[model samples]
Target: MVIRTKFMFRAGVTVLALSFSAPALTHPHVFAEARLDVNTDSNGNVASLHHVWRFDDLFSSTVLVEFDKNQDLALDQSELEEVGNVVHASLADFNYFQLVTHDGKDVPMQAPERLIADFVDNQLIILFESAPDSPLPLSGKVEFGVYDPTFYTAIDFVEDSYMTVNNLPAGCSSSVVRPDPDEALAQNQQSLTDAFFNDPTGNDMSKIFATRLELTCSKDS
Candidate 1:
């Protein structure tokens, strides 16, 4: 059965564009499990961000119905490619749902050249690599997080092993930071006003609940 609920794709195929009341704006209509790998260059500078996102079954089923042109009940390679293309194009409007910073300054990321989509266990998986517009030297502190600023989709790093640093330099360590929901809400109450929900591109209030990855490298290293 084709699910014809209120779900609408905007930021990406996995994201839902809901027109719900302000009280319901905080709740996500879609969900995804994400795995991130920070790849470093030979000089130990961050080169690119690799992502593997597995969408929830309900959203995946909706995608299959929309993109499975043959009505064969299974997505073929070409069908999957079509899904990937749509997601890659749509995600650009939302910075691919990536948040990267160096020493508290925002780091710009280039659009991914391509995205690979696959279906497994009734879920849709997307894989892509996003590189910084310029090389980001591994110094001081670097932070990364995946989130839907509009709060239409909830992306979670469900496992400790889901976040990793590859080719990390010596004397550097990485850790995950899961914010306290109550504390975050209390601190950002003003930013979460009704205006925030109405404006999609308004201040990013989602950061308060984002699960972030922090990387610290010793200057001597």
Candidate 2:
């Protein structure tokens, strides 16, 4: 999972247009702050948990979240619970772990084993999965809340993946592995960050808004 702490990098896939109440999407300008991503394990289990809030994209926005596991991505058949600021979303209820089948067939979804969470640039991602290569098609729903972020002070939650996750660092150089792993990982991260944050030469932004994200079958795809 990939996440953006300051702002979200997505404006097309998750939410297309913004509310007039928010009005950022009326012109569809890029919002490169405050977002998250969640994926599944190779066996379709959620392997991580990541949350980031870019203080810059605020309309008194209380929170930005994605809910409704609405799919069969090997849920644990349990409800979600939260204690104070700490929230717990059951295995199947994560953002990207939502299971999608070829013809709506039930498959193996053991439960949430692990969660991979990250916040880079203006995006955030959380992935929960057990194994790898489980033939699980990614599908799920996300929710972003904007209660009163307009006035809230900026939050400091940006850090390196290794520093934040407390892992020993896999030391992957890039998303692509041909020659250099370290350089590649760094480049991949920077490239993704740049794409999400930097607007084109002629494009500019005025405001930011939050909305729903719907990813479903293409009907004929």
Candidate 3:
């Protein structure tokens, strides 16, 4: 039996269709560039994370086709809102593709109240904010990254400027750490075996390749 969720039926079709033109072993069907802003509270704790994700042209074209109800060849404000809602709802199953860790422990995030979508230059841009279930202190190490565990969507923090920290304390610092893909694959050989290949979504193998933002704070401050 073939099971397709609303998201798979709508967006996955475009990905699968596009995949045929690429190398057979190519994993990701869709591509996106992401920007993140980490907001801090007065007490030097993480308050929220704001995200801006822009989809590739091919995927954006499919979205336009699906949501441009009036066939106007342009996405109006209402149409954009619908797109945002659909994308936001669809991401719930994947925890919004958010990965946050503090001292090697996963940090739980609360869903954002809104996801704003805009169509620009034939691309789809989505903006949203998510907050940790509780305030995350900045004294220890914190890592943040975004990836699709299913390996269907490749989200890239293409440049160092893609990530920012807001209202940060005096002694806090942040840096972007991009993993060497070849090195990561070599190190995780055993974990990335056939079982992972068969059901990529069942595990977080994508983390090995995800570009991360590392935040650190001095104990004195």
Candidate 4:
């Protein structure tokens, strides 16, 4: 589904239209400070992934003006809900910018629900939860990462402490793995060009820079 809200529709896809003459640029135009929480059941089965994304002030200002329909320079709850609906619908095709793996196999995720949106300090904060296609047991290993595959939006986990596991069985532990691109990719960062970002339809270079979260359960647990 395409972005439906006046604010997110523009911010989601047209971020580069401000400075770039070409809309085809694949590099990131909008940026987000992200936080992810992995929730598990008492028996150590994966429950859901709760995400909080804070849009940078540049794009947040745009959302504020467009979504604040009251002309009061403030966004009310109803206005925020409208933005949430649009974002929830728009991101389905993008896998909500997330990838999951269970025991070395890909884990599909269904569309997220319970979306909440709010504007604060010239920034837009979005809250949502995504569930796996099937029940995932915290067994040998469960890994996942959050990123914009198209490289159209840059999403970064700002705080290490915020990425945590909750309600898991004893002996289960989790950690966030920061990305470290290879020297070739590092030295050529900006020079890599759109081809690197474009990659092939089946593969994306952005995943190389994605921040991974890993959960491991002790065999005894």
Candidate 5:
């Protein structure tokens, strides 16, 4: 949904920007400030992830106007609910754009259990929770990242200190990284044309630009 929201919001700025030209897409159209609250169970296994996504003013202004069907100049409770429903439905296709991995293996996550949308200061802020399809041990290398595989929406960590882990094992700690694509990939995005946008299951280029959180825990002897 973040991806769709990104494109929709960007399209509002200029319709021609959708042409997908390399120079035109040099910078992402939509920017979202994001935070991840990782929670672990008593066994030191990850239980769930709470996410807060705040969209930029340009996008939010458009969304607020569109959703305020009554022309109240404010998104009422029903309007907010509509926003939540739409986001939840759209993001279902992207697995809510949340990715988790442990020791180089993908960690499947279930759909968001709940989504709350609110308009604040001309910005749209969404809060939701996602749990692993199955509990994942915090031991070894655990990582989490959120991004639109198609690169339509650029998700960023709002603050290094705000992306946090709660109840992690005693010896475990977390770190964050935002990686940039190599020169070759950067120079030639033609290979990453709109094909993947139609079917994101095939494109992972966005991961290269995603914000990654890594957790390391002590191993038992």
Candidate 6:
């Protein structure tokens, strides 16, 4: 099933700068540029959809999962085997060590190279790529709810941090704050608002410094 959602916010500034002690991280910021597009059908009822997702991780996975088999059922040796009989380079036979190392899979890296997870629409999307190989920012599909962990969990085996309410700037509109600890994420959507654009220049971003951000995590991890 294809999950349809719109991730409520985006960063205006580079966030990687937040983690000073965490060396495993390099690109901590999230950037997205959506091409607002309109689709026309037989009756001329204009439908709008942004070919959205400045997902550096998602973009790269596409390159990998492109090797998938089973008619898009999943990515595995069977997919790679389609191109060859021996199937030397397949998902199952992949070297996780190499994948993690290449993708910076730790403090430096947030998500795994390959993943499949339950989205807000509660659907699983097969991630086929990693980060952007080119200089340009990466992007993909458009989402509709607010759940970094929900989206990140599939690709990221472990969640270190994300766009959280604790760090939210001013001008952000929502029921509350977002990108908080996993346990605390199960609250009202009001914690997160539909105000932030893909740009980092959110209206309420300054709140990060002013607010006490109600978060739930070990103070000293």
Cα lDDT of all candidates, in order? Answer: 0.80, 0.27, 0.78, 0.71, 0.74, 0.24
**Over the stretch 96-140, how does candidate 2's per-residue lDDT look in tens digits?**
222222333433434444444433332333333332235433333
Ranking by lDDT: 1, 3, 5, 4, 2, 6
Over the stretch 2-119, how does candidate 5's per-residue lDDT look in tens digits? 3544244453542111222223233466678998999888887888999999998887887787777788899999989888887777777667888788887888888886689998
Q: After superposition, how far is residue 78 of candidate 3 from its true place, in Å?
A: 2.0
Identify the superior model by TM-score, candidate 2 or candidate 4: 4
Error of 1 at 14 (Å): 16
* TM match of model 5 to true structure: 0.81
Candidate 3 ranges beyond 4 A from true positions:
1-26
Candidate 1, pairs of clashing residues: none
Q: Which is the winner by TM-score between candidate 1 and candidate 6?
A: 1
For each predicted model, how many residue pairs clash, with residues at least 3 apart or on different chains? 0, 62, 0, 0, 0, 38
- Score candidate 6 by lDDT: 0.24
Q: What stretches of model 2 exceed 4 Å from their correct place?
A: 1-97, 130-221
TM for every model, in the order presented, reads 0.85, 0.22, 0.85, 0.78, 0.81, 0.18
lDDT value, residue 160 of candidate 4: 84
How far off is residue 146 in model 4, in Å?
1.1
Candidate 6 lDDT at 111 equals 23
